[model samples]
Every structure is written in C-alpha cells, then in structure tokens.
Target: MEYPLAAANACLNAITTVALIGGRVAIARGNREAHKRWMLSAVCLSGVFLVCYVMHHAQHGSVKFIGPDGARGIYFLILAPHIVLAASLVVLVPKLLWHSFRGNFDAHRRTASWTWPIWMIVSVSGVIVYVMNYLLWR
Candidate 1:
C-alpha cells in the first residue's frame, strides 16, 4: 500500500527535531563527541526527509491548504518561513557539517548558532503544516 507521504514527512520532521535537541543538549554539556554524533544523525535524517519530500511533491504536486480564512493566514504564516529556511538548509547544513568535520570549531559554532533555530523552526513548522493541512483540516 502507498503510505501517506505527508504523514511520513511529519514523522521525519519529528525525528529530526529530537535529534537536534539532543545534539544541542550534548554541546551545552560540553560533550563534543556526543554532540557530533547527534547532529550528524540529524543531518542524515533530514537528508532522507528532503529526498522523500521532493519525491512526494514531484509525484503528487502541491497539497493545497484548505481551511477558514483565519486558519489559512496562520498556515501561511508558518509555512512561508518554513519554506525559506528549508531551502536555505540545502546549502547551510552541508556547510555546517563541513566545518564540524574539518575541525573548525569556531566556524562550526558560529554557523551552528544560526543554523540551529532555523532548523528547529523548519522541522517543527513542517509538522504544524502537516497537522493543519492533513489532520486538523481533513
């Protein structure tokens, strides 16, 4: 059976969120190795999510937001930023990872400080969009 791609994407987003939080906590505790592991896992999960997301959209086209006017505005409010960051991550994430892997801690930290919140927002708002478009409004 064909699974619901939106739901699958949401699950990936949640997984990425948990990994991101874990990575952040690891770093905050000064556990560099643990932070690296968790953040790498997040990157891998997000990479998978991107592939699936693109495939789903390619196959199914856009899933329109359907709801009351107020809800529609709210949905776009969340979606617009999510989309912009999501696109930015295609470059930002790889650059962040490269800095980490190259032992450039200062550069890594600098970029990660910016990348983290944006990534969190994109991951979380993805689930919010899924819920609003698929579950709540369905």
Candidate 2:
C-alpha cells in the first residue's frame, strides 16, 4: 500500500521543530547533554524527512498549490524562504553537529546562533506548507 508520505513528512517536520525548541531550551538551561541529545534527534529526523520527501516527490512529482488568490500568494511567500533555508540547513546542521562533536563549543555556538532560528522557521514553515497544500486549502 502507498503511504501518505506528504502527511508523514509534515509530521516529521513538526517533530523536528519540537526537538529544535527542546534543544534550545536545554542549552539555555545549561543542560549540555540534553541539548546534544535533542539537537541530534532533530538532525536525524530531518535527515529521514529529507529522504522520504525526495522519494515521495520522485515518485509522485510536484503537488501544486490550490487556494484563493491572496492565500496562494502568501503560501508562496512562506514557501520561498522555507525552501531556501531548508537547503541551507542541509549543510549548516551537519556542520553545526560536527563542531559540537569535535568539542568546538565556541564555533558550534556561533553557528548554532544562526542555525537555530533558521531551522525553526524552516521546520515550522514546512508544516504550514503541508497544511496549506494538503489540509486547509485542499
């Protein structure tokens, strides 16, 4: 049976967003270990999501957006940035993890300072895209 991959991808995006928030909170509270665990989980989930997303789209091709004029424009506005940052995270996230694993806290922190917000926005906007495309707009 074919899986509902788009919905699944959206769920994964939500999970990654939660993990990102948790990691941020963990570090803010001085819980390095928790931060590491949560961030790593976010990275792993995102990796899986990317694979599933690529496969689904490979099989199914693009799913066009259908909505009212204003909403459609807004969707593209959110989607544009989300796509850009999601691509950036493909590199930034792994680099951020590598720095942390290598005990380069200073570098890690510097990169993460930028990575966190972008990642959060991408993850959240991903879900918004899914909702706009598959749920609300559909």
Candidate 3:
C-alpha cells in the first residue's frame, strides 16, 4: 500500500507537471479555455498527489541511500530542493487557483509563471528521488 501510494504520487506528479507545461503551450497558442482547463486539472491532480504523498511518507520513514557518504550527501542535496519547492508549491497552488477562478487573467499569468517552473522542478525532482530511493538504492 505504501509503495503504491508512492508510485501513484510520482506518476500523478509527472502528469501534472506535463499538464502545467502543456497548459502554457495552450496559452501561447491562444487557447485560453484549454489552458485554463489544463491548469485547473493539473492543480487538482497535484493536490491529490500531495495527499497521497503525505500518507506515504507518514507510513514510511526517510529512504536511505546505499552508497558512500559522498553519494549520500548528494542525495540529500537533491532531496532538500525537492522538499522545499514542494512545500512552496503547495502554498502557492491554492492562491494561483483562486486567481484563475476569479477570472483574473493578469494575476493568473503572473502566478502561473511562478508556479509552472516550480511545479516542473518539484515533479522532476520527485521522480529523481523515487528512482534513487526505489531503484538505485534498492
């Protein structure tokens, strides 16, 4: 159950990351409605992942790296950014969603501009963390 939660969290995070990028593309293509839908969906999916992610981590302690001290240090460095940005993303996401829902285009654009890259970083870092934990160190 824990691993499945982790896997689902990773998969959904990746999908939402892509959705955020695709939403930007949709905006660039002048498909405003499509962009809105995609962005909203991405936010929702990420929210779901966040909840499952919390559950997984609550059930499972920190994953260890099976390597030299140097490697472990590097792993923690990657983990730090992922954790920090993930926390930021959670706090900012709702504000972004609210602005979008209120039909505030400028506010949405500014918020999305910040959210997109952070979301991508959090998502990609999540996969890296998962691979390092479940595969490389397994």
What is the TM-score of each predicted model, taking all chains together?
A: 0.96, 0.95, 0.89
lDDT of 2 by residue, 12-114 (tens): 9999999999999999999999998999899999989999999889988988887888898899999999999999998998899799889999999999999
In model 2, what lDDT does residue 54 have?
95
For each predicted model, how many residue pairs clash, with residues at least 3 apart or on different chains?
Answer: 0, 0, 0
lDDT of 3 by residue, 39-138 (tens): 8888888879878877887888665567667677777898899999988987788888788789887997898787788888888888887777776656
Query: What lDDT does the true structure give each of the candidates?
Result: 0.91, 0.92, 0.82
Candidate topping lDDT: 2
Query: Any idea what lDDT model 1 has?
Result: 0.91
lDDT of 1 at 128: 96
Q: For residue 53, what is the lDDT in candidate 2?
A: 98
Tens-digit lDDT track of model 1 for 38-125: 9989999998898899889998898787788889989999999999999999999999989988999899999999999999999999
- Put the candidates in lDDT order, highest first: 2, 1, 3
Q: Which pairs, if any, clash in model 2?
A: none
Every model: Cα RMSD to truth: 1.4, 1.5, 1.8
lDDT of 3 at 47: 79
**Which prediction has more favorable lDDT, 2 or 3?**
2
- List clashing residue pairs in candidate 3: none
